[model samples]
Target: MPAGSPKVPVKFDKVQKYFGPVKVLEQFDLDVAPGEFLVLLGASGSGKTTALRILSGLETATAGRVVIGERDVTNILPKYRDVSMVFQSYALYPHKTVAENIGFPLKVRRVAKAEMDSAIRDAASQVQLGDLLDRYPRELSGGQRQRVALARAIIRRPSVFLMDEPLSNLDAKLRGYMRAELKHMQQALGITTIYVTHDQIEAMTLAHRVAILDRGVLQQLATPAEIYNDPANLFVAQFIGSPPMNIVRGGLEGRYFLTNGARIDSPVGGHVDKAILGVRPEDCAVVAPENVALKGVIYTTELIGDHTLVTVEIGHDKLTVKASKDIHGNQGDTVGVALRREHLYVFDAASGQRIR
Candidate 1:
């Protein structure tokens, strides 16, 4: 989206989809503001990709409407929807040069040769592919191929950008590089973007807001920080973090979480026969095993550069503790885990719902 490129909102209103006997999206509702970067995040079979496809007119919704800006585009053909999509596959033309590939969108609409060439160069330059415009897809690296796809999408100047795991093909390092380029490019262009990915890193690093879905249902939608810090349910709490938020099966006794004969105080108060106490690895401290509520033998230790992740076996469950990088511990060493009450989360065991 260049300086005056159209910026529009997107919405999915009470959307539902089913594949014969199996339901996909159930009452899915989401609203994306104008020029906002929204990421649809979920694992495979979560229906995230299906929702995106419906919006792009590639897959028709079983029920409900898809709105782009002020128009109800549920029945519109893709080309007439005024939206651009970049798929997991780069989808570049093998026989076409980068310039020709990028300018293809305009060429279809019969833009003048001079204008098409200018637009192609502008789009290529935006993705830092200017110097390689004459190269064919075969000559470009994975990242370059991705950029060509991006440039192709850009030349359309569509009202919305739809990307489906666009960088999944690249190597890890290249993926990271492209993620940065994508964030920068999106910010520069200010296009209303709807990106779909299973990678939480991409969802966290690139989105203005994230819509987390599970089993075709939108689990939670919020800013990445909010979703990370205050997950809506047990599923979200466990799904978000790397190494993940630790779940200790327990019962609630007053303000304490009772687990394996250990009574730990928590910030939230509730009582349930079957409950779970959730805490992030970083929230627990490793200390000397002396009259502590949690004393465990070290199961394993991993030095993850910035921190040493200590896995402590407390009874039947294990808790991961983020300790100092230089911390020393061997297998079966007894240690104490000190948990701060403020960081603990309580959830219902039966429903997997967060207990306020």
Candidate 2:
């Protein structure tokens, strides 16, 4: 393939995987656009990694099909699938120098020595490892080793890139830095990439679209903003946000949601004996009890640098509210939580599906 050639799309058509009687992927269907970064996000055993592994030809589907662009590659060998993978462990050769490791893929294909060296240099420079080509993996930092793995994957210039939590091994600071780096590199390469990670932050920051899975079933597939703002169901609403979305089990009466001796005005009015009220932390504000919708006592407060996370006790449940740094409150202080009717999400308590 020529450099900068138009990338190809990846498709999973009713893809299913099973280990004996347990189904790991339940008729999963997704389409990844050309040059797009799609992140598969879920907690452990959610089948996110299994989906990626199937796409990369590391694992075969028990049924359904895997297609890469115009071709059906359901049973193709990993090497023949024309895709490269960067693993979570930064699978670099400990004894091999950076140059050797980066060039190993090209070398396996029997590229000319001169051409391989040029490609290695270009890939190394792209990742800012040009000067460390002669150093071994043991001599480099975690981030540097990850870069080597990335460079090796990129050197192939494959149609697709599979990344399985490639930044999970790095420290918090390093992971943030590398997330930016990975985003930039993927844009520069314009390759179809499927990234698997359990971290919502990574999925939110890096993906053009996020596919959220739960227990082998795909819950939602949409852009990060859409997923965060308009969650399809209770699982999506609860899984994507920091501190998670506050879900209060209550009853819907007339035009109000009744919960914990408090009633908040609801835009969607209907009588339901049981319903779930969803709201993000940032959507709730601490305000004077007389002007607020619901009142609660402060259970605890956490200073998270930019803002303070205030947990308020509402009956038996606690709701976290993101308060401005300038606001200060102590435990046991009675405070009011102001919630906007527009920001409140309503879900069916029985089905865990959005009411809207």
Angstrom error at residue 194, model 1: 0.5
Candidate 1 lDDT tens digits, 1-356: 23346789999999999999899999999999999999999999999999999999999999999999999999999888989999999888899999999998888899989888888889999899999988999999989999999999988888899999999999999999999999998888888999999999999999999999999999999999999999999999988998899989989878888998889997778779999999999999889989688889999999999899999999889999999999988999999999878889999999999888
Give each model a TM-score.
Answer: 0.98, 0.97
lDDT of each: 0.92, 0.92
How high a TM-score does candidate 1 get? 0.98
lDDT of 2 by residue, 141-198 (tens): 9999999999999998999999999999999999999999999999988999999999
